[model samples]
Target: MLEDDPFHAELVGSWLRAAGHTCTVTESGEAFIRQLGRESFDLLILDWVIPDIAGDEVLARVRTMLSDMPPVMFVTSRDSEVEIAMILRAGGDDYMVKPARKLELLARVEALGRRRSAGENDIIEAEPYRIDTAARTLFMHGEPVVLTNTEFELARYLFRNVGRMLSRGHLLESIWGRSANVNTRTVDTYLSRLRKKLSLGPETGWRLSAIYQHGYRLEHMGIRSREGAAAAE
Candidate 1:
């Protein structure tokens, strides 16, 4: 853990040890960088608001230093939609808002550990859909669906926040990394394309819906099978 706050660091260290993890706590980016030069760890938990150097910078440096580093869990107090999106785009594996529950912290840590152990790259699956982040290809119902980089990022963001309604600003900043250059129209254009590609059908419970001026959400309609059409008939 790289956190400047002693209390927070000790609490997290205590939790990790209780969970049977061998953890080391450090208070500054300089120390962390020096430690990285001498020791290797299974995973890293970084505080977003750390002093001396920002947590995002630490992650970026770590990536360059280590050919293969473990997953990272960002501990942040900023819950702004834009901040979270920025963190995710900066290559952070996952995030947790500050003052987090003990269980939630542990759960996020364990999840990070699992992803590290699995040695999986950018490929991910959510039900019948398969996304190869590296190949920049998506597969739905065994059919190939091509997507532009923007469309892919938009879909991936919505999919990651499934069942949650993101605001327009949140979507724009997350997908584009900043809102100064674009508007919600860009988000809508890509969303239309993603929906056309996903094509959940009546049998499948999956659907994407726009929440008025807010943002889009991925939903499971709870309907399944081609028989669903017959039942409706």
Candidate 2:
């Protein structure tokens, strides 16, 4: 948690610890960034204003450096609609006004943790592609494929809803959190990255299709039959 106010930081940190989460509190954005470099966190609770670097700028730097972005919640006194929108657009997953209620804060944090944990507990299989949710790992044809955290989550989500058309808004909310106000173009950019990284195409026995006036879908190319026949020999 990156917070300048000692009272709020202690309060939030205590609450998180009571709820069985390991909590780290940083009073400055610079310290937060340094800690982030050495540790991987599931969630980031940030204050809009900090002693050094502002929260939004810190978030931007983090997004630039990390491929598997952690869920970020801004806890700040800046409650203006414009400020909130700007923070969300910059990739903050959630926002809370200052003097936040303990219960609500705990609830949001738990929800983010649960969502991330859920993604890690199940395996999604699409023939050659094997995704281990718990391990956050992917394999293609028994060979491991390295995916950044966000990429792994996106690929798993697509595989989970295979053949289903998911709207851009739905994906943004689902993956980035309901509070995220990111543009649809962000989804397009990530989809392109996923496609190239995973080699999603006709020859790969999988197709990630874009629907006109709709969204996207990952379709299996029914190559299992060929594999089955070849195995029979």
Candidate 3:
């Protein structure tokens, strides 16, 4: 966590530690960038205004330097629409207004942590599909499936959370690294591409179901009941 205010830093750090996460709090953006260079982190909680440099500038630098950039959340008093848009455009995964509630903060942190954990394994297998994380490749039925970098990441995330309803916001945050100021239509477009490319349907025993007013779930076709089928239809 990069926070200039000592009190806020300690408060946030304690909250994270209580949730069983190890956290390092930095008082300046310069120190935060230095720590990032020395160590890798799963998530970053940043304050927009810092002593040495602004958080957005630090985020830009991090993006340029790191290939696998960690999830970043901005927690700051600056809650204007313009500021929020700018921060998200600059690569923040999530944005929170200052004096964050403990429960919401913990929830967001846990969500980001889950995304990181899901991505750590080098190889992932879901029956006919095999994913090679190191090479960023996907294979199905012993045959290779060509996927762009974004498409591969999206497929991996979906496979990792199979059977769970994943909100478009969650997918956007986990894959694109920005939760706010993004068009959910982008997710719809990708899902369409994935469904076509991977042959996801009843024939394959896998179905990506879009829940009305909710989100999407990747699940086995057999598990969906007749009523569920009717509703989906």
Candidate 4:
């Protein structure tokens, strides 16, 4: 964690350790970056109001340096919806207002861990489509289908637990990484994009669908590509 405040560092670090995670607390963004240069960490817990490099700037830098970057959570005092969205768009995994509850902090931390684990490294193969959780990449018929970061995130999440009905709110929180000030339509927009690119038609029986007011699901129909393509046209 990169937090200049001693009290905040101690509190969050302790919680993470209690959850069986190794926590390293740093006092400045510069120090955090320097430490990052020398080592690899599974996750970064950052303070937006830090000395030497703001949280958002630090996140961009980290992205450039780290391949397969680990998840990041912004622990800040700013609570506005706009602020939350800005941080998330800038590549933060999640955001929390200052003085968060221990339970809330732990839960967010755990969620990030789950997302990291569920990412590209955890590839799930259900025929023509294959998902790599750690790599956050999806392959259709052995060809990679390019996805934006958010799009890949949503796809991997659905692919990880195939056939499970995910609620919109749950998806919004998990895939976007924050609940404050986010438009639910954002989820629909991303899903629409995913459907257009990833859908294999009815032959493959692999489709992303909206369940009435619920969220979305990937249903396998046991159809292959050629047949599905013909059916689609």
Candidate 5:
């Protein structure tokens, strides 16, 4: 948790601990980022207003820096509807304007768990595809489809974030790690492989579309990819 206020930090931390979860409190975004780099967390809760780095910046950095980032919740005093929309659009899973009610806060936290499960479930489903994280295997229509390790990882990440726009940098960082010498086109290449091997065309009830100027989005329905090879351009 990244909260500058002492009373609120202690209050929320104590509440989380009482609810049978471990809590680590950080007073600054720098400390928060340092801790995140050092340890894996189930959820990330932060305030919009921080002493040094703004909460939104922290979130952007997390997206670019962390490979397997967890769900994020904004617990702050910013109550404007626009701010709420901005946070959600920026990939925050939940938002609660502080001073937070104990019951409501805990309820929101648990609700995030339901939405994401924080990767707790070793097996994840995206319609016809079932990915077994423990075994690094993928099954399409209950039949095994062989994929390279990196391909399986990319497929799992794409399936996990279905309906969300993911930038190429986000994909590269998540799949290839930050220090890897992979080019951005490498992402498109791997995505093309997944498309052909898994039949990710419009016929499959899932469409992995490449958005112009943006990156990719694997949507279950309601959107279609543009025609032509320019889809990857």
Candidate 6:
């Protein structure tokens, strides 16, 4: 979700969680666009007004960015009939006027999500990591990396949710089944193996950072090096 207001961002994020949805919030349009360029989401929630870019402009850019456009909803302070119609005509799937009631917001979100496209290509590509979903094979820097099914799933999940803090319980239930007789230690052990096997280190431009009490997040740090170079110049 792209929201500038701190209170609204927090409230909407909590509501989305309550509806069993994972949301990543951005306070500025620049950050929002950067994230969309790298990460994929099932649905989007936008506010009409933003700091760096207008919400409507972001909606339009999202349409042009992806071959398969995901559902986008507008949650703004505007309540006018014309504004609502404009949002819809501008590629927004749903619109809710703020302050959005909990039940109503969730309902609108759920409705938009029901129409989400499930069709995905067999190949998944992120920089330096290429995943062939159909073959269950992964390549790092164009070289094949042997991975067990479980390990592959973990890697794919991490890439899919880059920068999002995933808890141990969530990882276990997601990668290993809930019924699997594995503790959080299993998660740590595998992550360590991946960190070594995938060369997830500072020099490699990526980090599988372990957060205390939280789990891990796959952070792309390539930008830091570029920023450092620019500063030196």
Writing each residue's lDDT as its tens digit, candidate 5 over 152-228 gives: 98998887766666878778877897678999999999999999999986556678888886788887753344233
Clash totals in order: 2, 2, 0, 14, 0, 0
Query: Candidate 3 on 1-233: residue-level lDDT in tens?
Result: 99989999999899988876668898988888877655446689999888789888989888886666779999999989999999988889899998989999999988877887776788888867899988888998889998888899899988876766677766876788643566779998999999989988754668898877556888867645534665676
What is the lDDT, from 0 to 100, of the residue 67 in candidate 5?
A: 61
Local distance difference test values of all predictions, in order? 0.75, 0.82, 0.83, 0.79, 0.84, 0.81
lDDT of 6 by residue, 1-233 (tens): 99999999999899888766777999988799877765556688899888789998888887777655678889998899998998899888888888899999888887776665244556878768898887998898999999888889998878766766667777887788657899999999999998888888655567888878767778788877646745776
Query: What's the C-alpha lDDT at position 90 in model 3?
Result: 84
- Model 5 sits at a Cα RMSD from the real structure of 10.4
The list of candidate 1 runs beyond 4 A from truth reads 120-233
lDDT of 2 by residue, 1-233 (tens): 99999999898888888876668898988889877665456689999888789999999998876656778999999999999999999899899998899899999998887876666548777877889987889998888887888788799888876765677766776677655668889889999999988888655678888877567877876767436644665
Candidate 3 stretches greater than 4 Å from native: 117-233
Residue 201 of model 5, lDDT score: 68
Query: How many residue pairs clash in model 5?
Result: 0
Error of 5 at 159 (Å): 15
- lDDT for 24 in candidate 4 is 81
Superposed model 2: Cα runs more than 4 Å off: 118-233
In model 5, where do residues sit more than 4 Å from their true spots?
A: 118-233
Per-residue lDDT tens digits for candidate 4, residues 1-233, read: 88988998888888887876668888888889877765456688888888789888889898887655778999989899998999999899899898978999888888888887665446679787888866777898899999899888887777665665666776776766553577779888888988888874575567787878666767776546547567669
Measured by lDDT, the strongest candidate is: 5
The worst-scoring run of ten residues by lDDT in candidate 5 lies at 221-230
TM values, all candidates: 0.51, 0.55, 0.53, 0.53, 0.54, 0.54
